[model samples]
Target: MAKNLIQVIIAGGRVVGQAFTRALKQEYEASQRAAQRAGGGNQGRKSAANDTFTGMSLQEAKEILNVSDITDAEAIQKSYDHLFGVNEKSKGGSFYLQSKVVRAKERLDIELQSHSKQKRTDQPPDT
Candidate 1:
């Protein structure tokens, strides 16, 4: 009788274990499918970045500033000021337009800073 009870307990344990294992496998496969549909596992994170500024890039920022050279701080600032002024909310300007210009300017600043940092890191130290 005791041997029969032990066997039943072991079988019950195996059944419970298999149920959990199958559930975990299903969850993992669902996540994999979701990731594939999103392009990759990191696609969600990339989209979050894109959503921040309407998917604006460094080149787009430069274009919005209308600067032929992004390195020209004066020109970039002048263009930003001009665009910002024309889009002022109190001056009957479109607030949405003003916000876009602001985002572009901010994006360019971040890009410029990142590039400068990269250059500094790439250069050899002075003797």
Candidate 2:
């Protein structure tokens, strides 16, 4: 019957869709592992910290947060807070955007700390 044929086609389509999804997931995970392996070593911590959880770069994070001056912590926090609230899932906003805001804040914080540390180290000893 046509009904039986339709059912068989639907089932086949679902199987193909599931297989494609699984393959995509496996490929993504493998790529992430390879990136981690490549980033390992002396500069790993700094490099990893500079990147967002979703692999966004420092410049990208800064742009997302609308930050121009890395030393302006207050401005960065204000922008981050506004964007985070705007993207809150409970306010009919997207969880993905909310997470990106969070990751951007984290990356900026790391950069701020690294900057301050470098400044301290670069300064001559106090008399």
Candidate 3:
């Protein structure tokens, strides 16, 4: 019986194997969607650095940065420097880490600038 099954699979060649693979992939995708809907998927999870300026959730980023309690500019800068330094090592000569650091800095700077502007605007103008 096993021999017969093996022979049949071999006879079906690439087409049958591909069909099976496609079906498995579809099932996997469906399960992933269901998981996401249940809030048990990684799709909504944000890395620490991603929370900076890409419109990702700040809470998630703070958690990733491990500095959710610290909000000072100097502290944030120190954290950024530390994270960038760790990511600077190129395991595969890829510059992905550096790029991410640059993006995070840009986002932080923009946020800080906007915040300062808001603060200034809220003040009473000199008579």
Candidate 4:
């Protein structure tokens, strides 16, 4: 057998006393090598649609409000209301959750405005 081959004992969903130093080290090294090959340029990376709200990222805000359609104000408002309603302090809600809901709504509104303006600017002026 090879030295790399490790014998893990069988158990009922439990990892007994064991050493995985080699595995972890190998994983770390592999990740480092991959990073090096990818040009290590993390400066100009654009965020994904589902990343954060305007401040958090559009994706995060949407998730917070349980909204998937970014351009639909009605849907976003409805989702925000539902969440905010459920988290109202008077209704046994957490201040933190209510605040989060508010922020998400604000972010979505800003995003929509920005998107609308961008579209307007992109269109050719009346000739």
C-alpha local distance difference test of each model:
0.75, 0.82, 0.59, 0.69
Question: What would the per-residue lDDT of candidate 3 be over residues 73-103, giving only the tens digit for each residue?
Answer: 7866787777777777554433675555555
Candidate 3 has an lDDT of: 0.59
- In terms of lDDT, which candidate is stronger, 2 or 4? 2
Off by over 4 Å in 4: 1-55
Please report, as a residue range, the 10-residue window in candidate 1 with the lowest summed lDDT.
44-53
The candidate that achieves the highest lDDT relative to the unseen native structure: 2
In the predicted model 1, the residue pairs found to clash are none
Winner on lDDT between 1 and 2 is 2
TM-score of each: 0.55, 0.60, 0.43, 0.56
Per-residue lDDT of 1-127 in model 2, one digit per residue for the tens? 9999999999999999999999999987765665475375644446554563547777778899999998999999999989999998889999999898988888888778878998999999999
lDDT of 4 by residue, 1-127 (tens): 4433433324422343233666778877765554444334441122322123245666678889998888999999889889989999999999999998998898778778766887899999998
The candidate that wins on TM-score is: 2
Q: Write the per-residue lDDT of candidate 1 for residues 22-121, one digit (tens) a residue.
A: 9999988876664555356675434334434455755577778887676677888999999999989889999988887988888777656655777899
Output the TM-score of candidate 3.
0.43
Candidate ranking under TM-score, highest first, comes to 2, 4, 1, 3
